[model samples]
Every structure is written in structure tokens, then in C-alpha cells.
Target: MKKIAFATCVHLGLSCIEEIYRIGGSLDLLITLKDEKAKDKSGRIYLDEIANEHDIPLLKIDNINDQEVLSSLKEYQIDWLFIIGWSQIAKKDVLEAPTLGCIGMHPTLLPIGRGRAAIPWAIIKGLKETGVTMFKLDEGVDTGDIIGQGVIKLDQNTTATELYKKVDDMHIALIAKYWHDIVSNNVILTKQSSADATEWPGRKPEDGEILSSMTMDETDKLVRAVTHPYPGAYYKEKERTIRIWSAKTDENDGEIKLSDGYLIPIDYEIEGNYGR
Candidate 1:
């Protein structure tokens, strides 16, 4: 039986871990972080159940690259390390420790949307199609050889959260469909071309702020890109911080001049002084 190691930080990681267990493989180790503000209860309990079901030794590492983490991974004699949604960067040692090396799963297709918030960035930029990729980890951020990829269509009205679910589904399918091929080394790996790849800088909370002077379509995309599950786009209105949760852009029939970063509260709620 192939011995595999699983590392993750959020719900995405939890799903992968479960899939690994379902495949009847041996989990040498399971590494995860504690989420302080989990909205879903099943996420916490699900991880616990999987750990118990597989009888896999579990490690709660505060930092991904901590010395203890490296020591624990080495102790397990991990053959493959599957990483999902891990925030911390994997050091050279941990990546190299696994016999078949580590695989990093990204929500966006390689050589295109490479960054932390791929889904949101893609939607905000009005991308018509996006997908997920599972690749071999390398020294650079998301600059890895592609093992497998799955694509999804993006509609004009698609919200970030909506697009996120499509990517998540694609991710789950890819894992289940190709886990065997990956372990047996039957999978085809392709090198990501540097020329066609575009790097997207991850978004900050402030980046979501819509400029008043921006066109209706641009503002609409921004609004949807940061809607529920994500921090909604916001702007200052007098002394209050208003967060726009839902909006619909309409064509301006008459002359209505507005400045950049204008707070047009079509539909919003006050997020307290700190902006939630």
C-alpha cells in the first residue's frame, strides 16, 4: 500500500483528506491547523472523524515550516505529501522529504491565475473560463509542473462565491479521478510554459473598494467578486464604513457625475466602526 501524508489548512484540505481515506490508502500522517472562526461545524468534526477512521497520527502545527513539523514528517517516512490550501510556504526540506515529492493544488489553472485569491481575481477581471490544477511543488509560488487540470465556464453574472464552488467541485473530482494514476506514476505531467502564464497579485481588503468614477460594469464585477463568504467591497460614507453586500449595475440614463471611490449605497449594511 502506498503511504501518503496530507497537509491542509481549511475546508479544501479536509475534503482532500477524506478522499485519501476513501481510496483505501495508508495515511502516514495528517497535518493541519486550527481555525479560530470556522463557520461550519462539520468541518471540525469531519477532520476528527477522518483522523480516527484512518488511525493516522495527527499533528497540529502552528507553522507549516516549523522544525517540529519537519521532524514529524520525516518520522512518518511519508512517500507523498498532498497540500491543499496551506497558507505557509513549504521549505525545501519538507518538499524533498516525501519519496515522490509533494503536490500542491491551486484553484486556478496554471500559467494563468497563479496566486492566493485566484478565483476572486479571475472573476473581478472578467475571465470567461477558469479551472484548477494539481501540480508538483517547486521553489517559486505556484510555479510547478502540472499533473492534471480541470476547467469550468465563467458567466458574466457569476459571483466570486459561485465561481469558487465550481472550482471546489472540480478540485474534488480531480482528486478522486486521478488519485490512483498519481500514486502509480501513470499520470502525465506537463511543464507549465512561462510565456503564457500570467501572475496575479493577491487582493487586499482595500483593493475591493469601488471607485465612484468607475463604469457600472467594472463596479458590478468588483461587487460580485467580493460578495458573501468573501469580505464585501466597501467605501467610506461620511463617518460610517458601509459594506456593499449585493448590487446591480444599471445604465446611467441621465447625467450623474460621480467621483472615484464614491459610496453609492444601493444595498449595504453598516459594518461598525472597524468595518467588520
Candidate 2:
């Protein structure tokens, strides 16, 4: 049986673990980092339960760069290292520790939409298509040779939460289908074209703030992109922060004399904080 080391710190990582076990893949070691107890868009408790269920060797490391973690991984003789949703940029030594090298599962199509929150960013930008990429990890952030990629079309009404589910489904299927080839080092990797790729800086909580000058369409996109599983969008109203759960865009190009910074709340829920 092929031995694989799985490392991650989010719901996606947990899902990957469940999928791997369901497919009868060997999980020789599991590494996870401490994360906030906040629920994801799916309202699922992260990877904690899966780790306990599988009884996979777990490493609760504060940082991936820790020498103790590195030494433990070496002792396990990990054949393949699979990473998903790990926040820290891994060091070269840890990445190359596995005999087959490390593979990272990214939420966006390679060379484009690189960096954090790729799924939400793609939807907010009104992208027609986005997908997942499992690539060889390098020194750079998500800049690696692609081992496999799967694309999916985006619908006009697709919210970030919805798009995430589609990507998650694609990830599970791809990993099961390709794990053998990846572990054997027989997989064909395509080079990412730098010219065709574009990068987004990632969204900050402040980015979710609804600007008074923003158009209805822009506000709608913001609300949809961060609703539910995300913390939702926010705007200041009467010295209190208001959270927007849902919104609809009105394409009225005609002049309506509405005061600037005056917003019509279609649907909302108030939160104590201005931004998450």
C-alpha cells in the first residue's frame, strides 16, 4: 500500500481525509494546525472529527517549519505529502521531504486567481469559469508545476458558498482518480502560462464593507460572495455595523434622486462587530 502524508487546517482538508479513507488509500501520517473554532460556510466543524475517526498519526504543530515536526515526518518515511488549505508557506526542506515531492490542492485554476480566497474572489469578479489544481509545491506561493486540473462553469446566480461546494466535489473526485499516478510519479504535468495568468491580492474583512458610493450590482456581488459560510458583508449604519445576508441587484439606469450613502436594506442581520 502507498503511504501518504496529509497536511491541512480547514474543512477542505478534513473532507480530503474522509475521501482518502473511503477510497481505501493509506494515510500514513496526518498533520494539522490549530484553527479558530468558527464554522465554515458549510457549518461543518473542521477536520478534528475526521482525524479522530481515522486514528491517523496526528501532529499538532504550531508551525510547519518547526524542526520537531520535520523530524517526525522524516521518521515516518512519508512517500507522498498532500497539502490542502494550509495557511503558511511551507519551507523547501519540508516540501521535498516526501520521496514523490509535495502536492498542493489549490481552489483556483492555476496561474490565475492565485492566493487566498480564490473561490470567493473569482465569484465577486464575475468570472464565468473557475476550477481546482493539484500542483507540485515550490518556494513561491501556489506557483508550481501543475500535476492535474479540473474546470467547472460558473452560473450567474452562483454564490461563493455554492461555488465552493462545486470545487469541493471536483477535488474529491480528482484526488481519488489521480492518487495512484501521483504517488507513482507517472503523472503528466502541464506548465502554467504566465501571460494568461492573473493574481488577486485576496480579500480583507474591510473589503467586505459596503461603500456608500458602490452601485447596486457591486453591493449585490459583495453580499453574495461573502454570505453564509463566510462572515457576510458589512456596512456602517447609524454608528452600528450592519451585516448583509442577501441582496438583489436593480439595473435601473434611470435617474432616481436618492441621497448618497442611503441604502435600502433588502435582507440583513445585524452583528456586533464592524468587520470579521
Judge candidate 1 at residue 246 and give its lDDT. Answer: 70
Residue 181 in candidate 1 has what lDDT? 82
Clash pairs (backbone) in predicted model 2:
41-229
Output the lDDT of residue 146, model 2.
Answer: 92
Residue 246 Cα positional deviation in candidate 2, in Å, after optimal superposition: 0.5
Summarize candidate 1's per-residue lDDT along 126-211 as a digit string, tens digits.
98888999999988888989999898898888988788788778878888887898767676879999998888887788988766
- Candidate 2 ranges with C-alpha deviation above 4 Å: 34-55, 251-264, 271-276
What are the lDDT scores of the predictions, listed in order?
0.76, 0.76
Against the hidden reference, what TM-scores do the models get?
A: 0.86, 0.83
Question: Candidate 1: minimum summed lDDT over ten consecutive residues — where?
Answer: 254-263
Evaluate model 2: give its lDDT: 0.76
